[model samples]
Target: MNYLARDPYAPKRLIEIGEAARGLGVTARTLRYYQDQGLIRSHRLARNVRGYDLAAIEQLKAIVALRAVGLPVAAIRAILVLRDQPDAQVRALRSALAEALREQQAQIQRLAALAEGMASDDAALPPAIAGLQAPSPESATPSKP
Candidate 1:
């Protein structure tokens, strides 16, 4: 039995717009958006049909992942800009990522503390109150509840 592997030469033929969009799990419109942002470049074929190289598909995947994580397109563009530089862009992206991560961690800690406080309050409440004290029609109902 033979298993098919990716064809090393498959990328030689430029992929048409639809094929390229499908490869990147995005609509052609999204690819057009990327083009507008100068994120990916394509070529025109006969009758001006758009075509992209396999490398461009890979770039689209990166763009999707970074955008999904809330990173601005500008940051992603900066990261991509370093791709052609002599030095690795890891250093530039790393500092920004680290600062953002630190802020996120602090927010998480604050949220966890608030949750713990709420849990403590729940624990301290009397069982009757915790279980919901129904009004005898003599007592007023909780305005919030």
Candidate 2:
């Protein structure tokens, strides 16, 4: 027997678009967008409706995860193109993830600074607005070693 054929994790069945989308917690339109992007493929069954094999569903799961972290479709496509080469795939994904992490970290720092500014400006506000403000996180938390 071929090594790939004996793999336990290989998909055994296919599912329709609705079932696949619900299972993955995404809309059918999202699935179509992925299809349009050539990121995933679907089968046409009965009256031109779409169906997804388990392998496609698995790919959708990964695509959903990547998109959730704000990875661009192009980057995901670049990574997927290297799927057959695990080393290349990992390298591409690592580069994309690192770049994404830097963007998120910068955004987080900016938001934190904005919040800090808002807290500082609280004192200049009218008593009504000022009173509604919670204690700054720094003041609320006990100092750590």
Candidate 3:
């Protein structure tokens, strides 16, 4: 079978909650939690069988990413609420994502600076040991052990 030759434009298959959670890198409990919070929509398949739309999988991915970055459920809900109003919310979501990226960049820069400072001073120490040292120059001063 030439799976690589499969069409990219093919329609997405419906996924059950378990499959959706696995695809989105979350637990089935988390999916149930999102459902409880009305963050996602699902439908009943057959006797106690619940199925989710493929679009919900994408939403779950976004939700997982946002949560991974420390965004609260309420804030995530606000963004999901805007999903229905494409014209307005699309711009808002884009702006929010950009802002998040900028914040993450700033945090990375700060950590890098800290790491560089630690590496420059405290010579003759192992990298792992040096990393625990305070990043500030004051901390590098000799003192009673």
22-96, model 2: which lDDT tens digit per residue? 999988888888889889987765556677776787899999999899788899999999989999999999999
TM-score of 3: 0.56
User: Best candidate, lDDT-wise?
Assistant: 2
**TM-scores vs. true structure, each candidate:** 0.56, 0.72, 0.56
Clashing pairs in 1: none
CA-lDDT, candidates in order = 0.69, 0.79, 0.69
Give the lDDT of residue 86 in candidate 2. 100
Q: Quick one: best TM-score, which candidate?
A: 2
Q: Model 1 residue 131 lDDT?
A: 92
lDDT tens readout by residue for model 3, 1-145: 1112122443345566777778777777888888888888666544554567667777888888887875657767877788779877777666667777788899999888767766866546556665785558855765210
Backbone clashes (count) for model 1: 0
TM-score for model 2? Answer: 0.72
CA deviation > 4 Å runs, candidate 3: 1-14, 44-50, 61-73, 121-145
TM-score of 1: 0.56
List candidate 2 stretches off by more than 4 Å: 1-12, 121-145
Give the per-residue lDDT of model 1 (tens digit) for 1-31. 1222244433445677877778767778877
What is the alpha-carbon lDDT of model 2 when measured against the actual structure? 0.79
* Deviating ranges (above 4 Å) for candidate 1: 1-12, 86-88, 99-145
Considering summed lDDT, which 10 consecutive residues are worst modelled in model 2? Answer: 1-10
